[model samples]
Target chain A: MPPVVKIEEIHKIYDSGEVPVHAVRGVTLEIERGDFVALMGASGSGKSTLMNLLGCLDRPTRGRYLLDGIDVSQLDRNALADIRNQKLGFVFQGFNLLARTTALENVELPMLYGARKFTTKQIRERAMHCLDIVGLSQRFDHFPSQLSGGQQQRVAIARALVNEPQVLLADEPTGNLDTRTSAEVMGVFQKLNDEGITIVMVTHELDIAHFCKRNLILRDGVMVRDEAVSNRSFAATELEKLSSAEAAAKLTGAKT
Target chain B: MRFGSIIKVALRALMRNTMRSILTALGIIIGVGAVIAMVSIGNGAKAQVEAQVASLGQNVITVFSGSMSSGGMRGGWGSSPSLTIEDAEAIEREVTGIVGVSPEVRDRNQVLANGLNWNTSVNGESPDYPDIRSWKIASGAMFSDQDVRSVAKVCVIGKTVADQLFANGDPVGQTLRIRNIPFKVLGVLDSKGFNLFGQDQDDAVLVPYTSHMKRLSRRSYISSILIQAASADVIDKVQKDITEVLTQRRKGREPDFTVRNQVELAQTATATTQTMTLLLAAIASVSLLVGGIGIMNIMLVSVTERTREIGIRLAIGAHGSDVLMQFLIEATILSSLGGVIGILLGIGSSQLVSHLNGWPVLVSTASVVIAFVFSAAVGMFFGFYPARKAAQLDPIDALRYE
Candidate 1:
């Protein structure tokens, strides 16, 4: 199958009123369908800008970007918006759920803009199915403020998958969660990957990057390394180990 | 995005801040309300004036004698009787549009009837007086031409004179003594209420002009000629014809009379009321403008506050136009809602004002529709800048907005 995302020598420049800032300088990469990849970089490495370009939220300054075999770099604002709605989903570190909206409505947001028309019943059913996939079926009517941090991120993941996009782009999906909660979120992502959903996530932690099958590192707007993970960590097993360790610590404190 | 969903989203957003939305709409409410109320009052005043003019007489014109200069001391118009019974008869004979013409001679005198006395003006008029003045007799009949030719003292009593002189009975067939000359009441004139000048129109009596000329006043010339045109459209032409014929009869030395028509009086009254209404409506529209500004101000603030929400919607595949439409629809809904409420409030308040002040008020549907459309236009006009500002926001920048 053709690659779900293709970038050839893409460059992004930002005009900061004085000297121009080259946020992404001459980068090229590809990801096939169903591939689980993590992009890793330090601060100022231009990883976020690269993600924006790949997500079709921003156009490349020089070069072409093909999302699902279609060149999207030259599309106008409305066309890009349509492409984003039909073929892309994004998960942010902030969970970005509309504050007063319920989890089901948040999940339904992407489908509301989908290319295919959906009735209210279809929208509700599809949103409920996505919420079930994210293990948030019981929290469908709960608001983001009422949900825990981990659950809110799960709702965001459900929102990203509601439109059944070709690729899921997540930026620091676990940045605001505790260690065990991060592992729990990674477990949900692992299950999605096993079901043939392509995902490209950005993170700074090497340990979190190990949860993916492939890793790409950036340095100062350039690709520094690209390789398969020699020993990938299964999030389900890691989460089990974390909970057992916590249970053991609680037992020892109770005996003391 | 579908239109229904877009509206739903806008409604949701507005409901998130109900208090702010209501306050923003208040401006339009007051504006539309004031416009409707002021316009209604103006229309009512105009109608009242028209009714008063109509009551005086329909298509009626009056020819007043010119000022008389006696020994270089000039008296005002009608001070000298230049019009005559002959002139009134000539107008009826020569004018093509003249329906009826009556020579008038009036004097204030004490009228006694049924042992009760009242001070009233007694008018000596031709037999065609009732037809020319559009006056109807409640009972009995008007004096005939024979009555005028033979100098018969038959008269018609007005409603006010009837009530004051014959409090417990009808005045028709009763004897009324004017200038101590006993006159038989022929009929009672219909009540005309008060005129625009606040003068009681029914406090008068009508008699045969020959009777007044031969027996009471002994005046040879008549005071004025009350001419009724055939129709409203021919009033100006009739006035002109009367003026020309009178001038020719006087040998063109100088116009001995001034001709006036009710059409001119009606136009002047209508124009004044219309101007006042427009001024009031213009002042009321300022509030609508202020209301529009209120909407714009609130929309700007809402855009700034929802910067992150806009970013999220954009990232989720909302076109810039979608975001623009969302805010624009929000503003429109606010103003239109205000417009509807204002219409109701305006009508209610106008009715209230009419009840309290006893002033007639007519709420025209055209004005209501105009006020509504104007308010919606205000919403769209004032909403554009803020909606554009929101639409132009970069998705990447918006997502990062804290």
Candidate 2:
């Protein structure tokens, strides 16, 4: 079977100013089915730009991108939007769940804009199922304001997954969460990956990179490293280790 | 996207800011309300004028003396008493489509009857006078043609004259003294309220033109002539025939009399109110335009305020057209909702005015429909620029918008 995402010599140039800014320079990569990739780079390193290209939020100035074996690099804005709707899901760092909307309604939004028509019943059931997948079934009716930071991120994840997209694109999905909540969110991603859903994440944290199957680093808009994570960290084990460390600290403090 | 979902999304967005939405629609409400109210008031005035014109009698024409240029000194209508009884008789003889003709001589004087005195107009007319003027006889009968020929001292007392002179008894078979000439009352005319000129129609007495000419007015020429056409369709033909016969009788006398039909009188009376209606509607429409501008201003502000929301939608696979449609639908919903409220408000307030002020107000369905459609159109027209701005936003920049 073909890889879910394939790109050859993808380049994005920003000519909005007198100075031409090459944001992404001749980056060639592939993401296989069920692969979890952490696209890592510092600020201004073009990781966000590459992520935008991969998610079809933008088109490359020069490249051939085949998402699910269909060439979408040259598609117009509306066609690209359709491809993004059907083939990709996105989770943002800010937990971009629409304000004042319930978790279930946020999850159901993408389906409302989908090319295929869905009955209200189907939409509700499907949104519920996605919330269930993210362990937020009980919190479906809770609005973003009502949810905690981690719960809100989870709701956003459920929204991303509701369309059943082949590749989930998460841009700093846990950047706002604390260490423990980050692990919990990573655990959810790991669980989704285990269920054979591909995910591509952008994060600057080294420890966060270890949660993925592979890590790619970019420097000056050029790919610098592409390597398997030899010491992969399961969020489940990390969370367990965190709780026990807390328990040991509590015990030590009691003895003192 | 499904149209139903788009509407749902738009309604939800509007409901999210209910206070702002209501404020935004208030402009349209006032605009449409003013339009409806102004038009209704104008229409009401026009209807009242038309009703008064109808009171002048149906299919009737009048020929007033002296709208002529003699020796280069032009005189307005009724300036000089030039129409004579012979002219009225000639029209009655020569005009084919005329039903009746009456020579009229009008005078105002104080009279005594039943040991009481009152000042009122005394009109001298033929036996066809009551029929020509559509005036009804409340009691007793009109004086016969023999009474007119013999210059009988018989008259029909109006209700106002009867009530004033014969306070305790019927005026019929009683006497009313006009210019100190005692004339026996033959009948009493039914009360007709004030005319368009605010003149009380029932505050007068009718006597034969012969008696009025010989005893009261004492002139050879009559003041005017009233002629009733056989039917409405023949009014123009009958008028033309009268003009021809009178012109021939004058024999190059510069056509001293002016002929007028009821239709012309009605048109002249209604023209001012029609202009007022149009002017009021025009002014009202300017306010509506201002209201449209208000909508555009709010929509522009809304687009800016909800930039992040639009970004989220676009990033989540919403097409630009979808965003445009959503905003457009939101504007339409706001304006059309305002339109409905304004229509109800207009009707309510007009009815209130009519009830409170005793002013006639006609609320036409056409005006309501036009106001509604205009409001909706205002929404669409003013909403386009802001909606287009939202639609043209780049998803990448939009998603990144703080």
Candidate 3:
């Protein structure tokens, strides 16, 4: 079977200001279906730009991009939008759930703009199922403001998955969460990956990269490292270790 | 995207900023309201004038003594007394399609009756006066043709004259002294509120033109001749015939008379109100235009404020056209809703004006429909730029907008 995403000699340049910026130099990559990959880079390292190209949010300056076996690199803006709606999902760092909207409605938003028509009942059922997958079915009616940061991120993740897209692209999905909540969110991702959902996440944190099966690191607009994670961290095990360590510290303080 | 969803999304967005939306819609509301109110008041004035003109009786024509001419030194209508009693008699004999003819001789004098006195107009008319003027006598009866030929001392007193001079008793069968001449009140006229010229039509007593010309004022000629045609279809023919007969009677002398029909009277009376209505509507539409600008201003602000929301939608696979549709729907809903409320407000205010200040007011469905359509069009027209601006936004820059 062909890879879900295959990019050949992809390049992205920005001529916005006086000095031209080659945000992403020629980089070729491929990701098989159900693979969980992490993209790691420092600020200004063009990770975001590369992620945008992969998500079809922005087109590459020069390259061939095949998403889910369709060549999307030559498509117009509207066609790209259709590709995004039908095959690619996005979870942003800021948990970009529409404010004042309930979690279920936020999840249902992608379907509202999708190519296929859905009845209201079908949309509601599908959104509820996605929220259930993210452990947020109980908070379906809760607004983003009412949820904790981790819950809001979960809602955003549910929104990303509602379309059943082939690729889930998350940009710093846990950037604003605490360590325990970050681990919890990663656990959700790991569980989904175990069920054969492909994910590509971008993050600067080394520990966050360890949660994925593979890591690709960029520096100065070039890929510096591409390797399978040798000492991968499991979020479920890390969360367990964290709770035990907290229990031990509490016991020691009580004895003192 | 489905139209229903687009509308739902727009409504939700508007609800998010309820106060600002209401304020923006207020501009359209007031604009439409002003348009409706001004048109209604103008229409009401026209209706009042038409009703008053109709009171002069249907298919009626008037021959005044003075002609309207630009070349000669101007003397307004009724300035010269050239209509003699013979001229009225000649019109009655020669003119066809005429139902009634009355030689009107008007004078203002102190009338005394039932030990009371009042200053009122005394009109000299034939027995056909009541029928010609469409006036109904409340009691007794109009004097007979024999009374007119015999120069009877009988008269008909109007309601206002009756009220002022015979407050305690029936005016009919009583003595009404006009200019120190005692005349019997044959009947009392039903009240007619006022005429187009604001003259009190009911403050008058009617006597035979013979008595008015030969005894009351001692004048050789009548003031004007009021003629009623058989039907509306022949009023012009009747008027032309009267002019021809009168001109021939003058034996080739430059005719000193002017002819007018009810239609001309109505047109002349309503022309000012029509112009005023148009001017007011123009001014009101300017405000509606201002209101449209207000909508554009607010929509631009909303587009700026919701840039982040737009970015998120775009990233989630919303087409630029979707964003445009959503914003356009939002503006249209705001304006059309304002238009509906404004129509109600306009009607209510016009009714209040009519009730409180005693001014006439008419609310027409055509105006309401026009106001609604205009407001909606205004929304579409003014909303285009901002909606396009939102639709053309770069998703990357918009998503990153702080």
Q: List candidate 3 segments past 4 Å from native.
A: B36-42, B67-76, B79-81, B84-99, B108-119, B145-152, B175-182, B214-220, B229-238, B248-251, B277-287, B337-356
Report the C-alpha lDDT of model 1 over A74-105, residue by residue, as the tens digit.
Answer: 99998999998989889999999998999999
Q: What share of the true interface contacts does candidate 1 keep?
A: 0.81
Writing each residue's lDDT as its tens digit, candidate 3 over B105-178 gives: 99899988777889988889998899999999999999888888888898998888988988887878889788
lDDT of 1 by residue, B100-128 (tens): 88889988888887788999988899888
| After superposition, candidate 2 runs with Cα above 4 Å error | B67-76, B79-82, B93-100, B144-151, B179-181, B230-234, B351-357
DockQ: the better of candidates 1 and 3: 1
TM of each candidate vs. truth: 0.94, 0.93, 0.90
Q: How much of the real interface does each model capture, measured as fnat?
A: 0.81, 0.70, 0.66
Could you tell me which 10 consecutive residues in candidate 1 chain B have the lowest summed lDDT?
A: B126-135
Candidate 1 vs candidate 3: which has greater lDDT?
3
Across A159-188, the per-residue lDDT of candidate 3 in tens digits comes to 999889999999999999989999999999
CA lDDT, candidate 3, residue A145: 94
Q: Each candidate's root-mean-square deviation in Å?
A: 2.3, 2.5, 3.3
Q: Give, for candidate 1 chain A, the lowest lDDT window spanning 10 residues.
A: A108-117
